[model samples]
Target: MDNLKFENILGWKVPEGSLPCWVISESERLFSIKEKKPFYDYSPCCYFKITQRLDNNFIEGHLGHSEYKGKRFHDDISTSYEYFSNYQKREPVYFSFDRVSLYRLIEIIPNKPLSFILKRVDSPKAIKPNRAFMIMPFKIENLDNFYQSYIKNYLKTEFNIDIYRADDFNDNDIIIETIYNQIEQSEFIIVETSHPNKNVFFEFGYAVAKDKEIITIQNTEIEKNLFFDRAHIRAIFYSFDNIDPFQKQLEHY
Candidate 1:
């Protein structure tokens, strides 16, 4: 483990000099973003044509370009699990999904603006996997139901994750310390900015301070504006419709 805390890499935007990854549709036009990856040279932007938007947030698309080919195995641990076991290595390796969609990663061209796009062609379904983070909006009086339902769905749907609450923690003494410790260690934070609650605001501030990923969702215009001021802080905003879209947004991250 890198002993480094997650805060060490907050707001680290990808350099603008980086190239774009193309997502092409079947008609030979390019549009729609499946995900983004680091840029690499010698790898042209791959293309995929949208075939259908399957129910349950799964999409079906056909691959148009083969410059960067094959579906990615998102789980790096499984790919390396046997190798590490054979070597008797106990150290955990850090994997970056941000690099998965990049092309020519195996080889790099020095200093050129490099880009790679992974296109989806002829895939039966574009799966919208549940994000590791949970988003809870407090205005819904059924806080307990909302929290429980999210946890249950994630567990039932086979999503592996780390969960953290952005509010309801006492700021004095051990409670604050314990909450901070948990947030510090978490991979994601859920902000319930439904009512502009002071506690939720504090929690959001802490998440921003620590540089952790956040998922902010609310139903009203007022709540959206409340979070709008903190655009400097990176987060995915959801206006109901489909929670899966927010999940897709996180997949890109």
Candidate 2:
């Protein structure tokens, strides 16, 4: 075990009696936006034990949750991890987990693994699995109708896959939390970048960091204005008069 590189353990089953692991984060714990006040209440630590090796890039595990009094609150919770190496980031790779909400594990004990798992926990209430997440500027003019007519209807009717956007959530829902949750549940992401929107870019970055399948779309008018760095990326350029081709292009993904 001492000589094992983190990458070598990718497909190795975590045997019983292996050391317990804790996920530590350098970043501050995020709170719900609906509170209107920041609450620095929770610890940045999460405990878990790897149970089974899913593949070269993922692992199945049980998450540990303890109460304030040091009593174990939850154990053997089913979860899966997405390896950090998949994203090809220069920064310290972190494990992204979807449990009560989206969270990351920056470090682990025993052996510091190069790859971290993106975990998805099963919710008590079954959520309809989302096919794609639409990341676009919500304030764009007549965009809702366009989404309703072309994007949403097209995906549903042609592929039988549901798509969600930030606007679909209720007003009471916390904005960032809801966005992360939806992205976690989605199999792929579709980003509209016709307009240079900070929020859209942020979402796109998040999706990329998570190594999600990304499909970018842009309006023909502003296609020249796309970020120079991202120009090489293939994007579907569409117009109001002709969106069928774009819809058909999405079907292959």
Candidate 3:
């Protein structure tokens, strides 16, 4: 980004010896008047919003939807319109201010030219959402069928989140690795501490190490002997009749 050069910022009213700030405004192009103190030159299309930063990087604000005209931008100063109109689709008009970063401007600008300049602005590597998460419930066998049914049914109904059972683990490390990776990326995790299996405890610890937000539930009575910190991590205490309570706890998770 340091190697890239940007045009200029508009509507910046920065005091000398200050950092940059973002603002919305009506009209004014902010720049170094004498390469020292800043000033504004009000023009015809000078109606735009301006926010001042300690420094001089100004982000131009529009009141409403606008069109990226060939050499100018057309926007309303009252409300944000539904969508901006189409322009001649020529080169983007870059207001001349000095403090804004080129990469940031590229992101804010529309109709940017596609070439080496754009390649530097748009990074090819980025993460995508919509990946599925798998969950594994511990002590599945020890729990009564009613309890198992309650856990599975409530998880899907309340959160609409899914998990794969640890029992599904095959001899393939690739499968296990994929499952673990998905868990690390999951938005929320649930670990049933009910009559814990060794693997479940390991999974719980792994989830904690990964800093995954977790919801812990236990069917057994809360153990006073457990460390206070561990007890604090528990999200819910559930029994046969306490399904509603469990659901309530998960509703906000």
What is candidate 2's lDDT per residue for 1-253, written digit by digit as tens? 2213322433332223232233323232222233322222433233444556555344544443322223231321222322223223433323232223433433233222222344432222113455678998875667767888898888898778899898776332135656876776587788898887899999888878777777888888666566786676667777778877877777666
Better of 1 and 2 by lDDT: 2
**What is model 3's C-alpha RMSD?**
18.9
Q: Which pairs of residues have clashing backbones in candidate 2?
A: 80-119, 81-117, 81-118, 82-117, 82-118
Candidates, ranked, TM-score: 2, 3, 1
- Tens digit per residue, CA lDDT, model 3, 21-107: 222121212233223222223221222222222223333332211233332233222123211211123323222111121212222
Per-residue error (Å), model 1, residue 159: 2.7
* Superior by TM-score: candidate 1 or candidate 2: 2
**Model 3 stretches with alpha carbons more than 4 Å out:** 1-139, 142-148, 221-226
Best by lDDT: 2
Q: Give the Å error, residue 248, model 1.
A: 3.7
Query: Model 2: runs farther than 4 Å from truth?
Result: 1-99, 102-130
Give per-residue CA lDDT, model 1, range 1-253, as digits (tens).
1212212442222122222123222222111123321211122232222234344223333222222223321111222333224223432211111212211111111212222122222211112233233434455655555555544344445455545453543232124433544555455666656665676677667767877777665544345554447655555555444556655664565
Worst-scoring 10-residue span by lDDT in model 1: 102-111
Give me the runs in candidate 1 sitting further than 4 Å from their true place.
1-140, 166-173, 226-228, 239-244, 250-253
